[model samples]
Target: MKKVINKPEQVVEEMLQGVVAAHPQYVKRIEGFNVLVRANGPTAKVALVSGGGSGHEPSHGGFVGRGMLDGAVAGAVFTSPTPDQVYEAVKAVDGDKGVLLIIKNYTGDVMNFEMAAEMAEADGIKVDKVVINDDVAVENSTWTTGRRGIAGTVLLHKIAGAKAETGADLTEVKRIAEKVIANVRSMGMALSPCIVPAAGKPSFTLAEDEMEIGMGIHGEPGTHRENIRSADEIASHLLEKIFADMPLQQGDEVAVLVNGLGATPLMELYVVNRKVAAVLNAKGIKTAKTFVGNYMTSLEMAGFSITLLKLDAELKALLLAPADTPAFVQF
Candidate 1:
């Protein structure tokens, strides 16, 4: 229950204030709401908005800038934002080209974002949406009906934002987003669980020498728990599941993301990436790009997740496009 905060209930509000203060040039708050919108305001192009619970920093909010999300709604730790909060984000960012909601596949996220979209539509705003189900770990989890969206959603954000930056229409932006969702697959493992601030206790427990594979980001049940294994073994186990689900073959070009859950060190993430690259190379799959570090995370959870996005020319081009955000920047 060791945490650095004044009060659990006030964590999200204080965090938003800090984020805006730190990055005023890039983002601003929606007055009294837990919403972050681009400081430059809405554009003539399609607007991108995505968010979930608050613990996964640098996600929907840190990604607000020139070439990423237009707005991001934040909820309590591991809880979905209210529809009104999401609606405020939509109203703040929507331009004539319309707004696209990049919702993860969590039950609450899906419901709340969709309700916001409908609310916007009634207000004469054109809104389109995409639900990301990139987690190959499980079919139905505690918070979602389908696969839970994990780090792969960040890739979707990059690709979709790049397309929107090109003045693409809403339909075109959503089409490209779906392409990324279709090609991407992710799976995660957890060494230790995180403690929600309000709860002041770990969400789950694990032994000193045990790890659970195919775990969701919110510390939900995974595929299995077993004695801790080497980095290579863990990487192989995850990659094998991905390959079985999608069957990546020879000559296939792919992008790899070795993401830290929260507490895992960069050294360990790079170790996992080394093994991931080896496995891909051994299968004759070409690695087009490799991203290592924390993209999406639980609240101080000890583990990592691997994400693979099979790439085509269009996807590769957009993924490599320039982006300037607080957490992710590409040139």
Candidate 2:
């Protein structure tokens, strides 16, 4: 229950204020909603909007900038944003070129974002949506009907945003996003659970020497829990599962993302990445690019996830494109 805040109920609001205050040049709040839109945007090109619960920072919100999301609607911690909030975000970011919504494959997220899309269509806004389900974990989890979307969503954002920035139409942008979704795979393990402020207790329990493989971001049940193992062993387990599902062949080029689940240190993430790269090399899967850090997180949870995107020329180019945002920037 140790959290820094005036009140549990006000965390989202205060956090939004802080985010807007810190990044005024990049984003602004929607006044009465928990939506954050790129400041002075809705450019002539297609606009991108995405969102979910608030705990995973630098995600749907921090990405609202030049080459990423145009708007983000944040819900309460681990809760889905209302359709009204998402609808407002669509309205704010929709240009004549149309808008795209990048949604994770959570049930609530899909339902809410779809409702918002329908509402926006009623208002004459051309909206298209893509649901990310890149996790190679179990098919159904506590909050989702299919495989949950994990860190791979960030890659989707970058690639899709880059396409949109090129003035691609909504259909084209969505097609690119779908390609990323189809080729990417991810798996995660958790060492510790996180405490939701309002709940005032850890979402789940784990022993000092235990970890759960394929754990969902919201502390949903994983494939199984067992005694913690060495970094190399953990990475092999995760990556092997991903490989079995996606089947990387000899000389296949891929991008790597070793994402922290909030509390894990960069040192540990790099350790995992080392093993990941070694595994890929031994399999003759050439690593095209490597990213290792805390990209997507489950508020204060201790763990990491690895995502591999099997790349083609188009995806590689879009991934390497320039982007300027609060959480991600590349020249």
Kindly report which residue pairs in candidate 2 clash with one another.
none
Error of 1 at 138 (Å): 0.7
Model 2 misplacement above 4 A: 140-144
In order, the Cα lDDT scores of the candidates are 0.93, 0.92
TM-score of each: 0.98, 0.98
User: Per-residue lDDT for 111-163 in model 2, tens only?
Assistant: 99999999999999999999999888875445447888889999999999999
Q: After superposition, how far is residue 168 of candidate 1 from its true place, in Å?
A: 0.4
* Residue range 1-331, candidate 1, lDDT tens digits: 7899999999999999999999999999999899999999898899999999989887879999988899999999999899999999999998889999999998899999999999999999999999999988885445447888899999999999999999999999999999999999999999999989999898789989999899888878798999999999999999998988899889999999999999999999999999999999899999888999989989899999999999999999999999999899998
Hey, what RMSD does candidate 2 come out at? 1.6
- Candidate 1 residue runs with Cα over 4 Å from true position: 140-144
Query: Highest lDDT, which number?
Result: 1
lDDT at 187, model 2: 96
Compute the lDDT of residue 201 as modeled in candidate 2. Answer: 96
